[model samples]
Target: MEQAELTALLTAQGLRMVDEIGPLATTGEVAAAVSRLRGAGHSPDLVAAVVGQAHLRTRAAAKFGPFADRMLFTRAGLEQATRLEIAARHAARFRDAGLTRVADLGCGIGGDALGFAGIGLDVVAVDADETTAALAAYNLAPFGEAATVRHGLAEDVDLAGVDAVWLDPARRTAGHSETSRTRPEDWSPSLDWVFDLAARMPVGVKLGPGLDRGLIPDDVEAQWISVDGSTIELVLWSGALRRDGVRRSALVVRTGAAHEITAASDADDEPVRELGAFVHEPEGAVIRARLIGDVARELQAGMLGEGIAYLTSDAALTSPFVQSFRVREAMPLKVPTINAALRWNGIGTLEIKKRGVDVDPAQFRRKLTLKGDASATLILTRVGEGKAAQRLALLVDRV
Candidate 1:
């Protein structure tokens, strides 16, 4: 949104219209609302901003939940903003560590800072983008004196008296929709600077889950979090915020329940074993944290193959760390062979999963015409080693 549109949206008149219009979820809904809004003598910019924000709130519901209804967002901000549930967890760490005064650097749309302020901490949130800072201030208005928003570079922010810092360095270039990923060195508040600050103070740095593990500092606790099945982020905690002896952590959150597995370092991979009754696919966070071996031990399972992440065991054991699937049949990884098996099993809907193999499930699905009501998950993978290795399809059911 332009500066003028934002100015208009900040007014009592503009926010009122947004609440009345509610969410314009569909393109058709947006068009009809835009036409009505324009016919009512609203300026083109105001109409555009209101309509766009309404649409975004509907989309943002997935991240912000009901809080989205009162919040304004840019396309990029909504995409990068931490989910409310995840943000709360970040806040709890600071509170538990007795760090009350917090600085949320690179505070996009006040997502994490809201978490801080909501917990009664004094939060000074800073954003490099002027518009984003304004929206953050607006979103955090309910907290009164507990929250402060500033439009400035994160590195320039004076951190004097701030007991703890939650640094979320901007990873994407500046834009609403056309932004691109920037190299780590290009990130605002460079990783080097962030790490230096982390060493001096209690700090929590939020980074992309896929960030290279080698770049992680040896002293900080690295926590990889996954919401549902998607690995969302990696958080590095330093100083007092770092839990004692917890170097690698995997936090899995499904619905509202959360489970965590922590270790001092990467756990050793268990030895490979023959395929058994149950095959387990570890959660993304577990794989990212390199804690697959810890989970494997808990389930009395071993690696399915030397390099593969899948685990197998005769026992049908399960845990929050992995999605357990019971093996039904195994066959050559050939289109005709799998197609015949699908037909024989009366399978119509198929969930094609592939690991350690080169195959496009969508394109490969075209070769098979499933015509029955049964549904099953087909895991295409390679088993064994060297010349003995062979590609095979394991038909399985969710346990």
Candidate 2:
């Protein structure tokens, strides 16, 4: 809805018209109210309210909150925010690099800005969207005078005295006219433009986790970040990317402890192996740090298949990155045996993970009859017996 009408409705309802509604209202009720406004063709303010509410509810409910307040709404465009730890890492990196004062150019909801301020660093968080700037203010409120939220274009913002700048361009393409997306390139200020700005000041560019490694600027430390097992974000650290593989690091953050995987050596090295009961998957940051082999060595596990991301162990080991499952049956790859085995187990839930297989999981599962209450993970791969084969890596649970 239009801001004027939305303001009026919020005033009438005594709602603050903030980033999201914290009331325990159901989505159906909110959707119905929004639908009524839409039916009247008045485009009520409840549209944003409903959207915001729905997003918050879904996000807060997820084991991992999907929303990152650091996501920016800059003049260039809107973009997703980075995870807290990832943002904090960047802030720490900049601080250690001697960047005393920094400008989060496209500071979205202030995710990274808060990280910077948390470390007692000087940060000027800038965003072009009024709504975003307001939200960022609330998110960064605890920082007090140490952090400031400004609504303006990055190029237009006065950042003369800052030693470093961080930017996350809006990466959504223009095709999102029918959706909520802005152009992907617009997510941050133009890269070329920002590059010019970075020539004078140190800069950090946050990009998609799946971004092409080739597109990474040579001078920037291109680092991919994965939290838990899920790869979340990639960071480009200009003035920090090192030839000796220094900037990239993989980290696994947990409730109790944190593990790290440093960058790989330039020399070709063998994978680490530990004869353990279970193999652990390294944290995403660890994997991105090119320390997967290092982790395997640390865990004393060996690779099961060539380029197989899974680590295998005969000993019971507790690690965050990999899950442990019993090799219940090592039968040859056959549909009849697979189907019979699955049906015998009453496989109600089937998780198919394959490294080198052409068969579709849906089709494979469809051919198998799963009955009663039971769950199992069916692994399909080329178990080279002169042919590719499928095996059931009976999963116990996420390690």
TM-score of each predicted structure versus truth: 0.99, 0.74
Model 2 C-alpha lDDT per residue in residues 104-182, reported as the tens digit of each score: 8878767788789878898899877666676577668777888988988887987778888888765654221123545
Q: Which RMSD values do the candidates have, in order?
A: 0.9, 5.3
Compared with the true structure, model 1 gives a TM-score of: 0.99
Clashing pairs in 1: none
| Tens digit of per-residue lDDT, candidate 1, span 1-399 | 788889889899999999999878899999999999999999998998999999999999999899999999988999999999999999999999999999999999999998998888999999999999999999999999899999999889899999999999989888876689999999998999999999999999999999988899999999999999999999999999999989999999999899999999999999888889999999999999999999999999998877899999998699999999999999999989998899899999999888999999899889887989999999999876677778989999999
- Candidate 2's C-alpha runs over 4 A off are 1-26, 32-43, 46-51, 54-79, 95-100, 128-131, 137-144, 174-188, 192-200, 240-247, 254-257, 264-289, 313-318, 372-374, 384-399
Off by over 4 Å in 1: none
